[model samples]
Target: MRKRVLDVAEESFQARGYHASSLGDLMMAAGITGGALHHHFPTKKALAMAVIEERVAAAVEQTWIAPLLAAASAREGVRSVFEAVAAELERQGFVRGCPLNNLAHELALADPDFRIALSGIFSTWRQALADKIASDQQAGVEQGTDPQRFAALAVAAYSGAMSMAKTAQDASILRDCLAALKPV
Candidate 1:
């Protein structure tokens, strides 16, 4: 029941934004009563925080961090990720942007806890990428670049590209941005 509620809330928040997804709607979607939801999450904010910390963070790990770490090279991994996501968005025929970015835009300024949680996730993501880059540099697969700076820039570029592609309703923007990021 707790997982059901969290799943419903995550989907709702992703589709409708935090402010717009009322508790009533979430309860209905999850097929749970107020008593059940409150038993697990005392407040809506608590539920949102759980969704961010668990669902959103896990999504980033599965989609970005794990894949990048598992690949033979950071450069190849990042590029492969870009291409895969572009193909996915193209197949879906719509862009929803990054889940983490969407939540950050909606809830970061609304509460300090939300900002802290989101920032922590972003920090973890950046650090993972930086680790991969540093490994590649040490292996002589890359050179003359600061891993931290490059990781930050790559994340920022992907976030901006996703936003633009979502707005333009075009996945090609992602591919074009991938071209610009060829050096890394």
Candidate 2:
């Protein structure tokens, strides 16, 4: 029941901004009573936080972390991550932007709790990429690259590309971004 509620809330929150989505809407969408919702999540904020921590974080883990971890080189890992995401976005017709970035844009300034939660996820993602870069540096794959700076740049570029794709409703923006990421 808890997981069901979370699943509904995650979809709702992603489709509609957190502030715009109310408990009543969630109850209706989830087909649950107010009491049932309150039983699973004491408040809407709690539900949003759970969606971020669980659903959003897990999405990043699957799309970014796992592939990066499995790659033989940081360059390959980063390229593969971008390619996979680009392909998926192209398939989906680039309808929705990244869930984390969407939430951050909606709630980062308006709510401190949400900002903290989203920031933590971004930090974890950046750190994961940085760790891979650091490993590659040690292995002499990336000699002059600064792991932290490069990681930050990559995240920024990807986030910007996603935003542009969503605005344009064009998956080619993502494909172009992926092409730009390739080494000369």
Candidate 3:
């Protein structure tokens, strides 16, 4: 039941902004009663935090971290992750944008707890990319690159492209962004 509630809440929160989505909406979508809902999550914030810590973080690990670890080079790893994400957007035919970015944009300023949680996720993501880049640099796969700066740039570029893609409702923005990231 707890997992069910979280699954529904994750979808709801991603589809609708956290501030705009209420417990009533989640309960209705999950087909659960108030008692049942509260039994698992004492408050909406709690539920959102759980979704961030569990679902969103796990998705990042699976989608980005695992691929990056297996990639032969930092550049290839970043490219692969971006290409995979772009392909997924094309497959869905709808760009809902990154769930973490969505929540960060909406709640980062208003809620400290949310800001902390989201920041942690971003830090983890950046660190993973940085570590991969550093490894590649040491292996001579990536020369003349500052792993930290490159990782930050890659993450920022992807986030900006995601925002533009979502706003324009065009998946091509992602492809273009990935193209820009490609080495000469």
The candidate that wins on TM-score is 3
Model 1: lDDT of residue 35:
94
Please list all clashing residue pairs in model 1, or write none if there are none.
none
Tell how far residue 163 is off in model 1, in angstroms: 1.0
Q: State the lDDT of candidate 1 residue by residue for 14-132, as single tens digits.
A: 88888999999999999999999999999999999999999999998998898899888877778877888999999999988888999999989999999999999999999998899
| Tens-digit lDDT string for candidate 3 (27-129) | 9989999999989899999999999999999988898889989988778888898999999999989988888899899989989999999999999989999
Q: What order do candidates take by TM-score, descending?
A: 3, 1, 2
| Model 2: residue 33 alpha-carbon error in angstroms | 0.3
Shift in Å, residue 95, candidate 1: 1.4
Score every model by TM-score. 0.96, 0.95, 0.96
The C-alpha lDDT values of all candidates are 0.89, 0.85, 0.89
Candidate 3: where is the Cα deviation over 4 Å?
none
- Give lDDT for model 2: 0.85
Q: State how far residue 47 of model 2 sits from its true place (Å).
A: 0.3
> Between candidates 2 and 3, which one is better according to TM-score?
3
Model 1 quality (TM-score): 0.96
lDDT digits (tens) for residues 45-108 of candidate 2 = 8898899999999999998888988998766777787788878877876458889999999989
